[model samples]
Target chain A: MKLMIYAAALFAGMSLSIEGAIYGELGKSIGKLESSFYNFFVGTIILAVVLLFFGKGSLSHTFKAPKWQLTGGLLGIFYLTILIVSIPLVGVGLSMISVIVGQMIMSIVIEHKGWLGSSPSKIQKEKAAAVVLMAASLFLIF
Target chain B: MSILILAAAVIGGVLLSAQSSINGAFSKQAGTYESTFLTFASGALVLFVGILFFGQGDISAILDAPKWQLSAVWFGVGYLFLTVLAVPKIGVIATNISTVIGQLSMGILIDHYGWFGGLQIPFDWQRGVAIVLMLAALRLIYIADRKSALQKKQAA
Candidate 1:
């Protein structure tokens, strides 16, 4: 279980790095909407392929996504499009710093309240301090 | 120019993080691919709506998008899947941090090497310090988890 979690973490990181590169490149060329739309359109194709091969009967399960899941999709579009747009404008360093700061702030509320079905955990002082320090470091570097 | 760029990055980061959390919420209820597809599909829907309501509805923009730009959608799909898979196992905080660290580490390399373009940011002392701090934060989070786990084991 732990190994799977670690593997997931590694993959998550790698995915983010790829995303940063894509944003950096795409931001220079296409407008936000076009870039994002095309990206998702392509993603749909890839997902379709997976469904046809390894997915088997799993494709049907995806259509049943709840109404709230739409919110997640909307957020994905906004976040990704913005990230792509920002990379060219701001540069990756500053963009990353700002995003991390926002994330740290929001994460506290999300985790504490269990807003997203996350296992509840208190926003202890140590964690809070760590977030603050991390933010500060990001600012200094950027 | 630098200020504007930084602002964009900040906005992008916040929006992405929030969206990821929303995706996380959906992932908890639905299966991973379902959540992934819903997020992308909904995002597409929102974009289309925005084009009609606010944008000029420029078909040219969509048509003109480079082939490579379109290819990035697959990466987005993969990213969503990874997030869904990791968030539940590592918890939100850890998963987010790990990804950020991964991004920064790779981003710095990409920038320094000018892999995509001739633009490169030299790795100065400040960047090194930032990397160390990030690693330390991860360590602290890990230690906290271990402490909690040991306590539970002792109690059991």
Candidate 2:
């Protein structure tokens, strides 16, 4: 558990710091659609090579999956474009604050409903406290 | 503008969390980087198809773009690996809170100096206090994690 927490700290700290700002700036110069397209374009080429050489996984199941299961890519389309545009208008910190809050609320809902075929976990008091702190931080962040 | 931006940010957040869990599940079947690769590959295909069907943007604009501006893809790769891996270990709350703290600090730095050509939004006292509180919450969450861990240890 301790080791996991430490690892999470290291990786989570690295995320949301630079990417949105960079993507936002790219969107500014090249347009959001084009910028996002290039991001995925480059990402695809690199991943394709890795998938071919390093991946032992098969895409057969992926093709057989339901349409909803495959919509992760569609979600990425919205997320990439939204962050790109939001950063320019609201600044990086505020934009991410919004993302955090959005995720928080929806997570609470997902937890309560167990919407995605997972076992339902009830929200504990400590989690509620954390949520309040996050909510308070949002006003200051904006 | 504020409303629109806030809505967009919220939507991005929801997607971010959802993808973390989804990709975490994917990591069970594939190598860590392999999972990341598959995600990007799928996303790329979607974007390409979107372009074919409805992207009204100029293709030349992307090709004509400067080289250095397209560096965020690597960051995407990094974030995805970390997110997919982290969620399984630390759960979503810890994963996201840590991510937000790092992102805010870096974001403030970038915004302070206007890095990456973004319009500068100078960091101020209100933002500072908010950040401090959020950091404190990290400690709070970690402590909770430890306590629960200890309880499990005792029960075991």
Candidate 3:
């Protein structure tokens, strides 16, 4: 079961790479923001159709759900907008590396403190090595 | 529940990549924000309808729920938009490698800390070794990229 999970993660990782390459082309032909807009618009349509027949989740509860849950759409816009802008200025690899490193730094704190609904897990010693290694790899890439 | 979360997260990651590529191709014709807008609009439409039919939860509770949970949705779209932009500029492999590295690094931390109600998977030496391996992989990719760039320069 664990192995299967790993394989699944691997597959997910592979798709991300392909996505980046294709999006790059799209960004060039149209525009960055426009490309992102196209994705969300079309996605909404397809999902609508699927939900019509198969919907199960209480999406209606969106109102009843925590307000924090509602911010996904807004956050989505922010992330995509920035990505569109950044990829052009920096190469994909470097941009991705920066994102990863940034996430690690923030998540370390988030996890340790149990902020944002995360269960508090104390930071382990190995984390230092992980960060250092990540930094070293980023340096090499740079 | 833990296993389910694991599966969902993994599958979600893969689909996100596919979405980025598809969006990239579509954006070529549609325009950037236009494409992005369509994605969100359509998605919102679907969710709305689904909630009407399949949703058991009260729509009105959104006002009552904690404000912070709303922040959850932003990360995904951000990832998608970035992937679309990066693919064409850097090519797929380079972009993929960087994202993978970033994602895995985060994933490890999340597992270690059990963030967002995820199961806690404490970091151990085995995980440390995995990190080392990841770095090595990064080094290899970097070298390959440099070599190709150098060859292109020589040919030019």
Candidate 4:
């Protein structure tokens, strides 16, 4: 059962990678903000009915949920816009490489601090070494 | 000048991962499409509100956009579907490793030819070595994860 979980996560990750590239292309096609908006538009259309049918939605909470919950959507907007703009300027490869570096750094801090409702975990030597490799790759890619 | 672009990319990646993590949590309580729908619905609301407040409210710009731009939604939808399937099967860490692999492989080709209108950067030995090393490190992490999981299971 656990192994199945790993396989599913791997699949999800791969799909995201493809989506990341597509987002860059979309950014080039329309522009960053529009691309993001369209993504939301299309995605909403795709799932709204199904979500309703599932009877699992709690959208009413949107009104009462803390201000922070609303901020979640902002993150998506920021990420899509940034990548879309950069992908054209830096090529997808270099763009993703740099992003990975940033992600590792941010993730490390998050883990160390246990911020965002996550449990704190220490970054081991191997983890630190992985960051080194990621940095070296970014430099080489440049 | 170049570093700014890289920095932007980094920020973008961070946001992407962060959103994914949060969405994964929502997916837990709600079914796959349910969570996805709510997430995108709220995203649309947030975007429209942000656009109205921060920038010109002229959303008509999207209508003039290219087919690819419009089609980009499919990828977004596609990603949500995959994660819905993957998170339940593989967990987020393993899923992330697969994503990096998928992303970089396409990234290399796209960068090499400047496909999709991105800046052209030919892949060379320097890039080759760096990518190899990065991938190696990722693989090591995956192995370690599996080993630890196995140990925990056995102990239990």
> What fraction of the correct interface contacts does each predicted structure contain?
0.49, 0.56, 0.04, 0.56
The lowest-lDDT stretch of 10 consecutive residues in candidate 4 chain A is A8-17
TM-score of each: 0.78, 0.83, 0.49, 0.82
Fraction of native contacts in model 3? 0.04
- Please report the candidate that would top lDDT against the real structure: 2
Q: Chain A: TM-score in each candidate? A: 0.76, 0.85, 0.81, 0.78
lDDT of 2 by residue, B49-109 (tens): 8777776666567666666666677776777667767777776656766776777677778
- lDDT string, candidate 4, A1-142, tens digits: 7666555455554445456567776665555676677777778887876576764656555555445444556787777777767776777777778777777777766657876555666665676788888888887766
Candidate 1's error at B79, in angstroms? 3.3
Every model's DockQ:
0.46, 0.52, 0.04, 0.48
Please, what are the lDDT tens digits per residue for candidate 1 over residues B20-119? 6776555555545655666566667777777666653344655675665555555556666687678777775577667777667776676666655525
Is candidate 3 or 4 superior in lDDT?
4
Please name the candidate that would achieve the greatest DockQ relative to the true structure: 2
iRMS of candidate 1, Å = 3.6
Candidate 2 regions exceeding 4 Å error are A1-15, B30-34, B53-56, B81-97, B143-156
Structural RMSD, model 4: 3.6
The order of the candidates by TM-score, greatest first, is 2, 4, 1, 3
| Tens digits of per-residue lDDT for model 1, A50-140 | 6556542333544565555457667667667667766665455556666666666676677678775565667766667767677767777
Give lDDT per model, in order: 0.64, 0.71, 0.49, 0.68
lDDT of 3 by residue, A36-92 (tens): 554455556554554566544444444354444334444444444444444444334
